[model samples]
Target: MERAEMKMKVLSTVTVERTDDFYKVVDQLNRTLKDKGLTFGFALDEKDSNKITMTIYEV
Candidate 1:
């Protein structure tokens, strides 16, 4: 048996202020919507300490 490969596409990228509460929203969305083909992720920008790079993807 073979497993099907799922491809992810980046739908949006935005720079936003890094805050604890904001991450809570992203985490909630991922927990609730990931199986529905959408996911949210974030990482601190290498050049900025006060901002985060948020990416929305289609799974």
Candidate 2:
């Protein structure tokens, strides 16, 4: 399949209480939204492990 390049944008960055299970939700979003031009990313706050930074991107 031929794909065209699209510009990526940072939709949002949210900091919330961290949980291991959040990875499952992020994974599901990536799988379900990749073709819709949206991607979800996640990272733990380096200074505070109890917080997670969730980033949504447009692609």
Candidate 3:
């Protein structure tokens, strides 16, 4: 079967000292997408020391 394509944008904020937290969030997001039969292309951005933004495109 062919996989469905979708586009998703996610934004998250974390303290600089807790940068690792972003990985967990990203992992969960990926899992959610996979469960929905979707693939993701991630565009990551560090808005600041306490802010981050991720844009995910399904391909």
Candidate 4:
């Protein structure tokens, strides 16, 4: 089976509360995309003091 490549496009930008345990959120992001049958292109972390902004892109 061949895996389909995700298009280069901006999907959405999500922000989560700042926390020491960030792995959960990252995992969730991966799961969410997988559930949607989408591939992850890239993620940009734009974090501030109290929150983190993630710009998600399709692969």
Number of the top TM-score candidate: 2
Better of 3 and 4 by lDDT: 4
Ranking of predictions according to lDDT: 2, 1, 4, 3
lDDT of 1 by residue, 13-49 (tens): 9998888788888999899997898989999988998
Error of 4 at 35 (Å): 8.6
Which candidate, 2 or 3, would have the higher lDDT against the true structure? Answer: 2
Q: Write the per-residue lDDT of candidate 3 for residues 1-59, one digit (tens) a residue.
A: 34355434443332333355667766887788876644433334555545445445444
Residue pairs with colliding backbones in model 2 are none
Q: Which 10 successive residues of model 4 have the least lDDT summed?
A: 38-47
**Steric collisions counted per model:** 0, 0, 0, 1
Residue 27 in candidate 4, Cα distance off native in Å: 3.0
Choose the strongest candidate by lDDT: 2
Better of 1 and 3 by lDDT: 1
Question: Candidate 4 lDDT, tens digit per residue, 6-54?
Answer: 3546678677676776756667777888666544332335445677666
Show model 1 residue runs off by greater than 4 Å.
Answer: 1-4
* Model 3 segments more than 4 A misplaced: 1-19, 35-47
TM-score of each: 0.79, 0.81, 0.40, 0.46
Off by over 4 Å in 4: 1-7, 31-47
lDDT of 1 at 5: 78
